[model samples]
Target: MSKEFEIAREFEVDATPEQVWDAVTSGTGGWLWPMEAPEPRVGGKGPFGSEVTAWEPPHRYTNRVEDVEGISEQTLNQLDYTIEPRDEGRRAWVRYVHSGIFVDDWDNQYDAAGRHTDFYLHTLRQYLTRFAGRPVTAFATFEGPEASSAAGAFTAVARALGLADDTAEGARVRAEGPEGKPLDAVVDYRDPYFIGLRTDDALIRFFGRGHWGHPVGVSVHDFAPGADAAADEAAWKGWLNGVFSQP
Candidate 1:
C-alpha cells in the first residue's frame, strides 16, 4: 500500500456561495447521502465515519474517513471539497477530491469510487435545483455480485430495460422486466455515469458504481405525502433485483 490513488471531479452549481454552503452543510446536504454529521468545523464528525480535518465555510472543507477494511482494505482515505463563487453570486464552482491507499487492488477500487462520486455529485445538484427545501423521503440499498464481478452490469441493466445507449435527460423511456411487468418511466436524467427515472410515485436513480463494484444501487425518493418509505424500499428492492437478475 505504498502508492495512493486519487479521484477528483469539478462541477458548476447554480446557486450563491452562501446557498451552496447551506446545501452542503446545514440544508439538504446530509439528505443527499442519508448520513449525519456534526456542524461543519474543525474536529467535527462527518458522514461515513469521517472526521472533519479542515473547515472553512462557503469556501473549503475536508475530512479523513475511517480506514475501510472489507473489500480489500484501504487506508488514509481523505475527501476534500472546495467551493468558489462564480457568476457574480448567482452560481458556484465545486471541486471534489478523494484519495486513498489500497493494499491490493487499486484500479477496481479507484474506478468504483470515481463512478460513485459522479453520481453523488449529480444528485447534490438535483437536490439544490429541483428538490431543495422540500421534505423528501429517501431510501437507498445495495445489491450483489460485487463491483469486481459486475463491472458493466449497470449499463447492462439499462440496456435490458430497453434504454438506448444515448438515452439522456428528457428521453421518453419504456421497458419490461423479466416478470413481464412494464417499466413506464421517463428519463429524468441519464449519462454514461448514471441514469435516473421518474415515475408517478417516486424518483428512481441508478448508478454504475457500487462497493467493490458488486452493487448497482437504486435510490427512491417518494413524491407523495405520508408515503410508506419502508414499504417503497422493500418494493424497489424486489423489483430491481428482478430487473437486474434477467438473463
Candidate 2:
C-alpha cells in the first residue's frame, strides 16, 4: 500500500543563512552522501536529478523527485529548505521538510526514515559549526554483518570505543581508530539510534539501525585535505567486521 510521509526538522546553525544555503545546495557531502553538484537556478537540475521547483538564494529552495533508481514511480519525493538569518548573530534558522509518498513497507520505511532525518540534520549542524566552508575531502560507508542486527549492536560498538550508555553530548571521547590509533573527538549528538562525533578531521556517524531491525553501519566524512577515502573505507570495513564477529 502506498502512503504519504513527511519528515520535518527545524534547527539553528552557527553559520549564516548564505552558508547554510551553500552547504545544502552545493556541499551535501560534508554531512550527507556525495551528490552531483546541483544546478543553480529555478527549473534547473537539482539533487537526485530532480527538478528545482523553487529557488530564492540563501533563503528558500525546493526540489521534486519522481525518478529514483530501484523505486516505483508511485513514489514522489520533495525536499524543501527554508533559511532565515538571525537578527543579531552569525546564525541561521533552517526549516527542512522532506515529504514523499512511499509504496512499499510504509511502516518500516517511515520509522527508518524518521530516525535518519534527525541524524542527518544533527550532522548538518556539526558541519556548519566546525567545518564551515571546508569541502568534504573523503567519504566512506561500512555496514555490519547481519548477525549484528541486534537492538544493542550500536551500543556494543560504543562500549568498545570506551563510551558508557550514559555518555552525554559535549563529552570528550577517546576511541580506537580503525588503524589502531587513538581518535579524539567530542560527542556532538547522541541518541538511541545514532551517535555523532566530530574530530578535527572528520565527522563520524555510528548507526543503530539494529534498533529498527536493520544492519548497523557507519559513515565517515573526512574534511582533511588529501584524505584517502578508499583506504578509509577498507580500514573501517575490517574494523566493523571484527565488531560484528564476521570471519
Candidate 3:
C-alpha cells in the first residue's frame, strides 16, 4: 500500500487575499509551466479534468485527482490553499498543503515534489512583490542532461549566464538567454537550491537540483506581449543540452 505524503507551507506575501486567490486558483502560468485554472465555486472543472473538491473565493481552494495521470502506478493527488488577509488587507498570509500518495519511487518523488514546492512558492512571492497583475505572455522550462547531476554543475550554469561568483540578492546580472534573449535583471531571490532573476519583462528561475542528485532545471516567465513560448522552450532546450554535454 502506498503511504500518504503531505507538504505544508505557511508564508506571507505583499498581495491581498484576492490576489493570492488569483495566483492559486486562476493559475500561475507565469511562474508555473502550465497556465490552468478551476472554476471559482466547488465542483468547477480543473484544467486536467480533476474535480474541484473545495472552493471559497479568495480564501480556500482544493482540487483532487483520484488517480494521477501519466503515472502507471495509482496515486491520489490533492493540493489545498488557504488564504487570510493581513494588515488591513494590504498583505496576506497563505497556508498551502500538497498531499498525495507515492505508489512508486517514494524517496525520489517526495524529494522532487518538496523541492518544487519550495521553489514554486518562492516564485509566487516574487511575482506578487514585483510583478503583480502582469499577465504572463509566455513561459518555458529548460532541463539539463543527467550528467548535470554531477558536482559543480550549477557553477558552470551560473557562469554561462554571466552571473558573478557569490552573487547575492540584489546583485545585477546581464546575460543572454536562448536565442540571445536579453536579460538585464537583478537577483531578487537566492538560496543554495534556487536563484531567481527579475528582468523588466520576465522572471527567470534556476533550480540547482543537481546538488540534490537531480538534473538542473530552469523556468522562464515572460511578461512581454506576443512572446514566443514554444520557440523559447526549444532555444532553451538546445542551450541547456549544450551546457551540460560539453567536456
Candidate 4:
C-alpha cells in the first residue's frame, strides 16, 4: 500500500477573494505560479499534466492527477484551494493530497508544491494590492522615432542593471515593437527609479516610471575601444542618431 501525504497552508490576504480568483483563473495569471500553463476550468488541462476536477469560482478549485512519470503505476494526486471571509478581508487555505505511490519518496515534490503555492498566493496579493484604490485608467507612452529599438535596448539595460528579471512579474512582454522587439516593457515599476549598464559598444540607460505613469526615458551612448573623451562623445551621439532614426 502506498502511504498518503497531506499538506495544508493558510494565508491572510488584503485583497478580496474575487480578485484572487480572477488572477488564479486567467492565463496571464498562470505565469505567477510554477506551472508552465494552467487552464482554470473544470476538466481543463494544467501543470503536472493534471486536470481540474472542480472549479467553484472565488470559493474553491481542485485538481486531479492524470499522469505521472517514473512511477510504476498511475495514482491519484489532488490539490484544492478555498477562500473565506475574515475580519479585515479574506483568508485562503490550500490543501494538497498525494495518494498511490511506489517506494514513497516524494519529499522533493512536496517541497516544490509548497513553494509554488506560496508564489501563486503572493502574486495574487500583489496584483490586487497594486490595482486597489487606484483608477483603472493608468497608462504609459514611448515617444521617440525609434521607440521600438529604444524599448528593446532599455529592457536589455534593465536586465543588466538588475531592475528586471527573467521571472519577475510584468517582465513578460506586453507589446511588441516594429522589428519584433518588445515595445512596452511592463515590470514591477517600483523603487530604485532607474538603471544603467554598458554594452560592448554602447552605454544603455533605463528610467523607471511608476506603474500607471509616464516612463522617464532611455538613451544609448557609443564607446570605442580606447578613443579619447571627445571622440567617444561624438561616436555616441552618432550611434544615438542612427538607432533613433529607424523607420
What local distance difference test score does each model get? Answer: 0.68, 0.85, 0.82, 0.46
Candidate 4 yields a Cα-based lDDT of 0.46
Candidate 2, residues 1-247: lDDT per residue as tens digits?
8899999989887899988998888845998888876678889998776889889998999998884655777888999999998966488999999998988788998989888998898888888888998989999987888977986788777876778889999999787877567789998888888888889999989998887788888899999989989988888877877777843
| Model 2 RMSD in angstroms | 1.7
Measured by lDDT, the strongest candidate is 2
Per residue, candidate 1 scores C-alpha lDDT tens digits across 1-247 of 4458888899898877776667666633223545565457789887767788889987888888756645344467888889999988789899889887866566776777777777777767766666655656545555534431366677776876688877778877776533556878778777765687766555677766543544766677765577766776676667667655556
- From the highest TM-score down, the ranking of the candidates is 2, 3, 1, 4
What lDDT does candidate 1 reach at residue 123?
67
The lDDT, on a scale of 0 to 1, for candidate 3 is 0.82
Runs of candidate 1 with Cα error greater than 4 angstroms are 27-31, 69-74, 144-152, 159-162, 174-193, 198-202, 209-213, 244-247
- Residues 171-206, candidate 3: write the lDDT tens digits: 887876765666788988777777788889888888
Q: 1 or 4, which is superior by TM-score? A: 1
Which residue segments of model 3 deviate by more than 4 Å? 70-74, 179-182, 211-214
Best-matching candidate per TM-score: 2
Which consecutive 10 residues in model 1 have the weakest lDDT in total? 140-149
| lDDT, ranked from best to worst | 2, 3, 1, 4
Per-residue alpha-carbon lDDT of candidate 4 for residues 165-238, written as tens digits (9 for 90 to 100): 54344453433222333433444332243433322233333343322133334433333344343443344344
